[model samples]
Target: MVALRIRPAIVLFGDSITEQAFGVEGKVGWASLLASDYARRADVLNRGFSGYNTQMALPLLPKVFPPSKDNQEGSGILFCTVFFGANDACLPGERQHVPIEEYAKNLETIIGTIRACFNIFSSAATKDDDKFPIILMTPPPFDPAAWRKCRDLEEDGRANNVAKSYGEKVLELGKSLGCSVLNVWNLLEGATSPEVYGRYLSDGLHLNEEGNRKVHEGLMELIGKDHPSLAPLEAGATGEGLAVEEKLWRELC
Candidate 1:
């Protein structure tokens, strides 16, 4: 009897940024790029929820990544990206607003859960699965003017200053927790005026085509540099190419 060999999952867990990662209207999203890059090698699962904050994500963790011993569905998580805080950075009275301190704590809790689950699942499979890489992404730059115009509101629900605070916290956590960080905030806003940075966003809050490309490029760069073994296979690839489940048709022929 043959045993089941499941493809390892690259989980993109977060808020609207992740949820919309596959994209719409003929636009390709960062997650979609990953899916293509890892085609036939790994499953890239999008677990993004629009309007969700860290506080809301906490309760969903268990259900999303259950224990492997109980359910093999959670057994082969290659890695996951945590991208939240956009909605959480909303104004004080907003429904999605979570205090900065609480948001930090919530992120810690979420990471802890993933580590625990990954350890259990991988340890059962093999000792070589000792490390589970996690990438924490900071919220992209928020353009209050764009958001106000997009939403047609007197005042935007989020502010750049408030969002920046959240991104900083994510950076701190990445260092302390030894997780790779995709600093979207810096990637989009680095020393640029709002006029320039604002172009990356669609509704001043979400990513546009160029913005998605930036994120996809950043992710590919990180995986190639930091986790080269997991990078997709290509011509003349050395350490960058990960082995696929089966040989290519050309190889078989």
Candidate 2:
């Protein structure tokens, strides 16, 4: 359970990208790095499930982000990033494929649910009162060359172009839903070299350090512009608005 002190949470919800955010083997994932950036300001919750598609991800939202009390005010969800599709775009017969059409619908449903959960504070406010926002991230591009060497190409899975299609659809969904987005697929593609694109993917699937850095940069850009409220508090201030314990340890010692 989250401590009452950390009422607001910056939730990083997605598949393996999230799961590996705070890496176990010493290297930190982008989410963990971002969490450090916002340390003391808010709690960053990681909700990544490896190999999960949208169909598998939808059911888990309510359990993690239940509705707040009707009158509760403030940043309950600081923000959430609904990232999926890496697995959903797997080619037919792969363990993770989901039809592209259904993928769009699933995203809509998830965003709607998120709004409802956060809307518990007011049923009468105009659109202006809605300050919170969710971000949607397109999955990173896949590398066929890496896949060919690491796994059987005949087994079925996505290629970089196929990933681009899914990524574009995600951008469209974000626009129609009025949500922000981080198009990592294109960001990576735009910056990577044709000769070294494989370096970005540790296994033609999971991200490597360079890929994670790209995600971190993309996310920081979005949050800095759209949701500055979620940024780390000034030096010593906590999310609540003041720094009650800034000097506590020194005083106690």
Candidate 3:
């Protein structure tokens, strides 16, 4: 029997923001964009759980990515993006609210688990030499004005300031731990006006098509710079003696 070529996985783990990454209704899903970019290059696995916070994500880690000795060559997780904090940034007394301090700890634990997987699965002689390929993403900015139109509530469940606070914590953890970080909050912060901000979101909480496009662009930029080997191959490259070959294809002819 021919041994099949194993494709490494690029895991996208997070909350509803992530779970809805493959958004419908003609909405462009950032996760889906990544999947397209990495087609035949790697598998993008979406492990986003709707309405989950760091606390909830902790318990689900082991089950989602069980340690395996067979994670060699093209197999196993090539990299993972840890993107939580949206739900956790909810106001105090809110259903999904998680304290900022506890949120930090949970993030650390998650990063550690991904590192451990590298050591367990990699053929590397020492863990110290291998830098784990992981990206920690900050939650996107919350637009309270847009949110109010959708929900009939006396009080807002989430606040932009609170979300910024969570984003800051993620940035801090990423710097201290030396992992790649994506500040989605800052990335999408350009929509300063209330009217403009609505364009990026579906219901103030979820991302719309244009918002997802911006995110995909940022992620691709990071990957191209930080994890160049894992970045998607571009089409039309000429080689020795002007021999051209097309490496880009969605499916076989």
Candidate 4:
């Protein structure tokens, strides 16, 4: 008889959306639901820190790396989802927005750090040719109507505009670095309208259940096309559990 082996799971690093899995009952984040969808196939670790920025994430890469084994080389983490720049674009006089240059540097540091870690862990058996895949996802477009209703329009506009600009730069960086990039901003722009925003956003910025569902479906489609291993998320019944787990992690963290 032959034994079957499982591959290491993917890691998600981001802010509230990623942390949504840890929300209280009935308020699970979309990412958590996504995780549950994949539970039968691959392990999905959600490391979303609410209100965090790229600067903070750049230093947390080590925690996401897989542990080493005794007999064989440590398995590499399959996917890394980098979703940031939200808190960095917080309202004026609140959280300071990271300058474009600094943002780029932070992302570069993250990618470099991950690559370096993979090299150190996998160097014993494999060559540089075998490297884990990394995915860079841009933050979703800020709902302007939602912003106007809940926040100071002028201020929110500035922040959203700034964040959008920086988001584009991040996408460009991803391409240059040879990483797979998901332009979430573009995806959400046309799908959502002012009326939709009013209902799906709790505060014009963060998403409500409907908003989360929309993002989740889009994410599944994107992941399915690019990363078939993650397709299970598109059709699974563990969304509730995944949501609970996400909420737990968020609160505990």
Say which candidate scores most in TM-score: 1
Better of 1 and 2 by TM-score: 1
Q: Indicate which candidate wins on lDDT.
A: 1
CA error at residue 116 for candidate 1, angstroms: 0.6
lDDT by residue (53-155, candidate 3, tens digit) is: 9999999978776666554455766788989999999988988999999999999999998788665775322234376778999988777867887786667
Residue 197 alpha-carbon offset, candidate 3, angstroms:
2.8
State how far residue 9 of model 2 sits from its true place (Å): 0.7
lDDT of 4 by residue, 1-253 (tens): 9545444556787877667744435776667676666665566768888878887776676666433333224444556778877666654466645767787889888877776665455422112325445778776656666677676565553345665677788788887876667766665562455464346556666667766767677777766666554345323245321121133334556
TM-score sort, best first: 1, 3, 2, 4
Give candidate 2 misplaced runs (Cα > 4 Å).
1-4, 68-75, 122-131, 152-156, 190-194, 236-253
Question: How far is 210's C-alpha from truth in model 4 (Å)?
Answer: 2.1
Quote each prediction's TM-score: 0.91, 0.83, 0.86, 0.71
Error of 1 at 122 (Å): 2.6
67-171: candidate 2 lDDT, tens digit per residue? 656324544566788889899888878778888889999988888887887766533222343734788999887777677777866543676677778889999
lDDT of 1: 0.84
Q: Candidate 3 vs. truth: CA RMSD? A: 4.6
- Score candidate 3 by lDDT: 0.79
List runs of model 1 lying over 4 Å from the truth.
Answer: 1-5, 73-75, 123-129, 235-240
Q: Candidate 2 at 215: error in angstroms? A: 0.6
**Residue 169 miss distance in model 1 (angstroms):** 0.5
Question: All models: lDDT?
Answer: 0.84, 0.75, 0.79, 0.63
